[model samples]
Target: MHGIEIAVSTVIFALRDDPRNDCTALGMPLVRRVRQPYEGSWALPGGPVRPDEDLTDTARRTLVETTALSPTYLEQLYTFGHVDRASKPVPGPRVISVVYWALVRPEEAERGIEDDNVAWHAADHPPELAFDHATIVDYALWRLRTKMEYSRIAQAFLGETFTLAQLRQVYEVVLQRTLDPANFRRQVESSGGVEPTGEYLVGGRHRPPKLYRHRAASDLADNGPLTRL
Candidate 1:
């Protein structure tokens, strides 16, 4: 009788230029399978879980080995283990995948490997993927968009300090909507989630804009007790 096999996968998002529109958009790296059930199809960066490694470690290792990415914001997303999740013409045992979602700044995203097998693609409009990866990608994107509304998760896409306009762009790109500059600035200021860094960004053609940083009291995401993790 076939037994269950455990694996780990990651959905890593980054803000980059959308090749389709030439505007900032969410993208993720995918690896093409070289063999077996879904050979030659794009899939998430992942591999089997090692006996000595925990789920998160396996997720991180696979990311580095497959795409050369090591995101700072990594969290357990969800588990997928439907009985038919791995069904195929080729013989294979049942697979239980523990999925993790990660966010990386654009600079970090550039570290990913781009080649015949690994490449970045628009996360919102991924190509035909192997297995149920399309479903998994949709779920991860939904979670990120939902959390972007009420959490400071947007900061994950930016650096240490940024102007209100820069921060708003992150929101616009991820949320896929334009926000009024004046209204957005007012709302962000009133939220108390960010504080002025008392520094101005120089070298811009227009007047320098004040830089702001995420407040220490506010965590990236409200993961309850897991906030410390």
Candidate 2:
């Protein structure tokens, strides 16, 4: 047995053009490890937690250092620390990772650095990953889809103003299902999570669609009681 080491990793989700589907799909960035235990394998962006640095700040820093992305919506997801989690013959102290998940707007996501070492992959069908990152990504996807059912978190993927159709598309792409346009519109309007911007989208051939934005006073999503602390 050896001393425990704390680390921070982030799963950043974004909507990107899925050439396979010719539409927007959920994607995430992975950085190729330059050193073993799994050198050359892609893994979530992260690093050893520096002394005196907060967990959230460390999570943000890892994203910037690896991917150059700074998403606005970030939340602590869960901690992963199993004695056998990395049972492979690795020469290092046991690592316990505090994981976070984030959502980024399309424009912001496009700015992420994508070189040979860092690249975006389709979240649902990601390639081989190092350690237990595959499991971590599954958990993050579950949490995101669960929250989308009852929260305005979907707005995190859109611009400040969007049409109802645009908002619904986000849910559909993430949830992997189709939502009734009428029902979705009615629910969103009644949910008090968004407000009309009093402006309509231009450049469309059909009648302009009224633009809406998340209510300024509302949090993207209800984070439970811990948010109050």
Candidate 3:
């Protein structure tokens, strides 16, 4: 009889600003595994699949189980299966894993997860991760960066009805570079991703700033896209 093992893992990404880029660039979260074969080591959230469960079902279930976080955007990223990955266990077959990329809203992130030990690190400077997780994260981020440049995915980083400045922050963080405000605003207008509310808020230390909400359809479509992060 042939036997196979399946597991689901997640690469959860959030927007974070770092001073290295002059308060630019964002990062993701990587949790430490408490199990053997990599016990007390850092890795993405993952768990073995139970019988009769689908690949994504395992990923979603594992996310809540480990992080107490329900990902707002969840999509299958990739599948990894290589020789010697499970050579330790005698008679054990190849272990195949399906990794997912998920994005969490800023508020949801601030609310945070139940696991206090989970540490959120900058994506550009990730720690030594267990197994092949570093490679996994790299791929996921590349996909996000590529998609963001052309698509309006960067809007996911902001709240409803945000100012041009807020939208620019998302790009700066993800790209790890400063965006020309004029060029950014021009591009945003052409994309039709946001519309001005003709309303301004005056709570900051400076003058009131204009606000705009990301189009509703764009938000919904984000939930539908199969992404790695």
User: Residues 13-117, candidate 1, lDDT per residue (tens digit)?
Assistant: 998875676788888999999997899999999999999998889999998898887786888899999988887656678999999998888888866576779
The clash count for each model shown is: 0, 0, 4
TM-score for candidate 2, residues paired by index: 0.93
C-alpha root-mean-square deviation, each candidate:
1.9, 1.8, 3.7
Model 3 steric clash pairs: 27-123, 101-228, 161-212, 161-213
Q: Per-residue lDDT of 1-229 in model 2, one digit per residue for the tens?
A: 3688889999999999866768988999999889888889999999989998999999989888888888869999999998756656675667899999988889988765767899999999998899999999999999999988877799999999999999999999999999999999999998999999999998855889999988888787457896686
TM-score of every candidate relative to the true structure: 0.93, 0.93, 0.84
Winner by lDDT: 2
Local distance difference test values of all predictions, in order: 0.88, 0.89, 0.77
Candidate 2 at residue 80, lDDT? 99
The residue-by-residue lDDT of candidate 3 on 1-229, one tens digit each, is: 5577788889988775454665644657678877666667688888898888888889889888877777667778888887656545333557778888888777666665567657778787888887777888899999889988778777766666788998888887787788999998898889887888998966965779888987766753354444433
Question: What value does the lDDT take at residue 67 in candidate 1?
Answer: 80
Model 1 lowest lDDT segment of ten: 220-229
Q: Which is the winner by TM-score between candidate 2 and candidate 3?
A: 2
The list of candidate 2 runs beyond 4 A from truth reads 89-91, 112-114, 224-229
